[model samples]
Target: MRKLQFPVIFALFCGMVACNGKSGNDSTPSSEENIKKEEVKIRKPVDQAGYDVLLQYIANDDTTGLWPVPDQPLPLEGAVLPYNRIVAYYGNLYSKNMGVLGEYPPDEVWRRLDKEVEAWKAADPNTPVLPAIHYIAVVAQGNAMKDGKWRFRMPAHQIDSALAIAKMRKALVFLDVQVGLSTVEEEIPQLEKYLLMPHVHLGIDPEFSMKDGTPPGKKIGTYDAKEINFCSEYLAELVRKNNLPPKILVIHRFTKGMLTNYKDIRLRPEVQIVINMDGFGRPELKYSTYERFIRPKPVQFTGFKLFYKNDVKQFPHHMLAPEELMKLRPRPVYIQYQ
Candidate 1:
C-alpha cells in the first residue's frame, strides 16, 4: 500500500494550472499555507427581488465593509449582503505600512482580485464590478512625471496584470495616481493608456500635493477645481474619442482646504467625477464630510470608505442607511471597504 501526500505548493500550482482540480494536497502545510488554502463553497446568487434592494441602497447610500483575506475561513453565515451601489475605493497600495505592489510578482495581486470578483459574482450575480486601481505613489515617485516626461514609476508588469484581470472580469478599475509635486494636468497624459481601457478609471490623491515642496508623513498638497477640471476635460475627450462610456474621475479630499476651489469645479457633461471624503482616522467626520463637500459636487456618483479594523472601532454604530443619506441630494454611487 502506498501512503501518498501532495505538497502545498503543488496543490496551489494545480489550482492555477487547471480550470478545476481536486483538493487536499499537503503532507503538512505550514500554518500560513493552510490558511490560504481554506476553501468555501461558492454560494448561488441571491433572489432577483434583491436586485431592487441593491439599487435602492446605491441610490440612498446604505453600505457595510466587506474585507477579503487571502487566508482564514470565512464565517458560515457567508450570506450575500447588500452594500452601497456607486463605487469602491481601495487604499494602502503605497503606504509604507502596506508593501508596494512592486514587492510582489505582478500576477499575484490580480490573482487575489480575481478570486474576490468570483466570490462576489457567486454571491450576487448582478453585483456590478467595481475593482480598485492603487499605488500611484510608486509611479513617478510623487512627481507625477519623470525627467520632464510623464511616466509611471510602478512596474509595467503590475499594471498589465491588473488590466488583464479587469478585462477578464469586465470590472471597473480606477487608476489611482498621486500628484506629488506636480499639477493634475501633468498626470493626465501619462494615465491615457490606462484611461482608454473600458474598465479603467482614475483616482487623484490631493493629500500628496505640496505647496513649498513635497508633503510629509502621508500628508501632501491640495487640489482645486482648476486642476481637477483640466484633467477631467482631457479625459472626457479621450473617452468620447474612443466612443466609450463616461469615465469616472475620483478625487480624495478630507478637509475643506484640500479642495480650495471645489465650488468652481465645473464637471463636464460628458464625464462623471466622484468626490471621496478620504480622511483617515475619524469616523464621526465621515457623515459630516460627505454632507458638506461631496453633497455639493455636481457629479452624481459620490464615494465613502471604511478601514477594515481601523475605522470600525471608531464608528461601531454600523452601516449607514441609503434612504437617510440619499435625501441630501447628489447621492453617492460607491462605498469602499478597505
Candidate 2:
C-alpha cells in the first residue's frame, strides 16, 4: 500500500462571527426590544423530538472518545432492519478485468450470483442474506478527460440495469464511485435520485480518490475522515428526510493510507458504516491484511472483498471460505466478490 502525499497547505476556518450593523455597547431599551423581535421573526421552529433523542444519547466528559460500534439490526427505536449480511457481486457492465459483473450476460451473472448468495445463506443461517449488485458507477481511466479528470461515469441506463438485476434478486443496489480528480461531494449528488430509493445504498472507493491530482491506478489514492464523514452525513440527512431505515455507507480500504483520521469519524444512528478490506491476495495474505488493516480499526461494521481471479493468482487455489471469514474477531457482515 502506498502512502498519501500529504498536502503542504491545509487550513480550517472556525466560527467567524458576523456583524449586523450594530455596535455591541450601543443597545438602548428600544433597540434591544427591536433586536429581540427581529430574532423571533427569523428563528425557525425547533425539532423538539429530535433534540430529545440527541440529549438521551449525549456522552459525558469521561466518555468523550468512546463511541461503540453499532450492533447488527441497529437499534433505532421503531425502525426495522432492512438487511443483515449483504453478499454483493462487484464490477461494472463495461470492463471484463473489473470483476464477474461484466464478464457474463445478465442471466448468467445472476445465476452465478445466486449461488454465492446461497453459500452465504447456508454459512450464516441465523442472519438473513441480502443479495446485492455493487456496480461501479464511475470508473477510473488511464487517459484524462476534457476536465483533466481521468474518470468515466457510467450512464443512467447502466445503473438502471443493475437496479433491475437487484430487483429480480429482491436485493439491494450499491452504486460504487471512484473519484479520479473529482470530489465525493461533487459525485454523490449526481446519484441523489437513485439513492433516495429505499433499496439503494452507496460505496466509495478511496483507491481512486486522487486528491493530489495524480491519475488513478498510477498510485493508490486516499480519503480523509472529512470526506468519509461528508458521505455519511449526506446519507443520514436523506434517511431523516425520507423516514427510511439506516443507510449503509461503505468505504473501501486495504491499506492504512487509503483512509485517514479514523478516530474523528462521527457515526450516527441514521447511518451504518462499514470499513471494508478491498484488497486481493492469497487466502493467508488476505486474512493477514484483514487482521492488520481492517479488524484492528473497527468501524460500525466490517466488510471483506474477494477477487475471483486476483485472489488465486498467487499460491492459493481457492478463496477464503465464508466460515473462515466468519471466524474473524468482528465478523464481516458484508462480503463483496469481484
Candidate 3:
C-alpha cells in the first residue's frame, strides 16, 4: 500500500515467483510447455490474439485499433503475463498501513489472501490466478534524514520473512522500491542477492522518486523511460545470466506525470512489464484514473489496484469487486490489494 491522496495515476509472473526459490519451472514442467504454446500464439504474423486480449481489457472498444502493443518480443519460457493473472498483496512489514501483506499476522494475511485469490479465480476462470507477496524493499520518507536520499532500505531479515511467507504457498514475491531521492541505478543493485533468485521480481515506484530534492509523500515523483529501461535491461541481464524464467517488472502509477515517455520504455523477452493503476478511490474515480492514464497508452500488460481502507473510507465506500474489474478495457492481468 502507498500514498493515494494524489488520487490519480497508474502501473508478473503469475506463479513464476514460485516458492522453493525457483522460477515457475521448479516443479511445474508444464509451465515451460505452456510457454512454447504461448510462443506460437505470440508469433502470429497479425498477432490477432494479442489484439483480442487488448480489446477484452478495454471492453472490446478499440475502434481505432491502436493498442495491441505491436511487436512485443515473445517472452522467454516461464513468463507469467498475458496468460495468468497475478493476485498480489502489497505492503511493508514495518507498517501495517502500507498494505495487507504486513497488516496482520502471516496466518491472517494468508487467510485473507487465499479468499481474494479464490475470488479472482472464479471471476476470470479462463486466466489462472496466482498468489503473490509484493513487499516494499525500499521505503520513501518525508524528510531527507541521512545522505538526503529520503529513503530507507529494509533489513535482510525482513525480506527473508517475505520470502518465507511466499514459500508457504509456493507464491511469487515482488520486491517493490520507492527511490525517493535515490536513483534506481543506485538502489536496485543492493537487492541483487534476493533478485538473483528466480522467484523474486522487481517493482519501481515513480511516485516517490524525487528528482528535485523534495521528500516523498509531500509531492509525487516521476520516472522517465530511460530510467525504466535501465531496470528492464538490468533484469534482462540477470535472467540471461541465471538462465531463469523471465523476470517481471512492476511500475506503479495513478497519475500521468508519475510515468513519462512510456513509448520509449523498451520491452524484452527476459522481462514481463506491468503498468499498475494503483490509486485509491471510488470505482468511478478509479476507473477514470485507469482510463486517463493506463488505457490509451500501450504497455505489454496492465494491472488494477484496490485499496481496502482508502477505497471504502467514504461514501459509496466499497472495494471494486473482482467481477467488476474484469469488465475493464484491455482487462488487467494483474491485480493488487492494499
Q: Largest lDDT belongs to which candidate?
A: 3
Best by TM-score: 3
lDDT of 3: 0.85
Q: Which one wins by lDDT: 1 or 3?
A: 3
Give the distance in Å from residue 197's predicted Cα in candidate 1 to where it truly belongs: 1.6
Which residue runs of candidate 1 sit more than 4 Å off their true CA positions? 1-152, 216-220, 296-299, 313-330
* TM-score of every candidate: 0.59, 0.77, 0.83
lDDT of 1 by residue, 1-338 (tens): 12344576677677664433234544545555555655322222334455445535444443322111112112112121233233342533434333333344446655755554454445444444455544353343533354532224556676676555446545566777765665667666876877887656778877766555643234546887788888788877875566655566778776777887665776553466667767545545667777576655433356665554455556464544334434544344554545
* Candidate 3 RMSD to the correct structure: 16.6
Clash tally for model 1: 12
**Which pairs of residues have clashing backbones in candidate 2?**
none
Tens digits of per-residue lDDT for model 2, 1-338:
12333332221111111133233434433445778976654323234465333322321121323223433223343222223688999999888989888898888988988898888888867667778899999888898998888888899998999888788878888899998999999999999999998778899999998977788998999999999899989998987777666678889998999999887788777777888899888988888887788766756667889988888888857888887876665667789999
TM-score of 2: 0.77
Please report the TM-score between candidate 3 and the true structure: 0.83
Candidate 1: 10-residue stretch with minimal lDDT: 66-75
Worst 10 residues of 2 by lDDT: 9-18
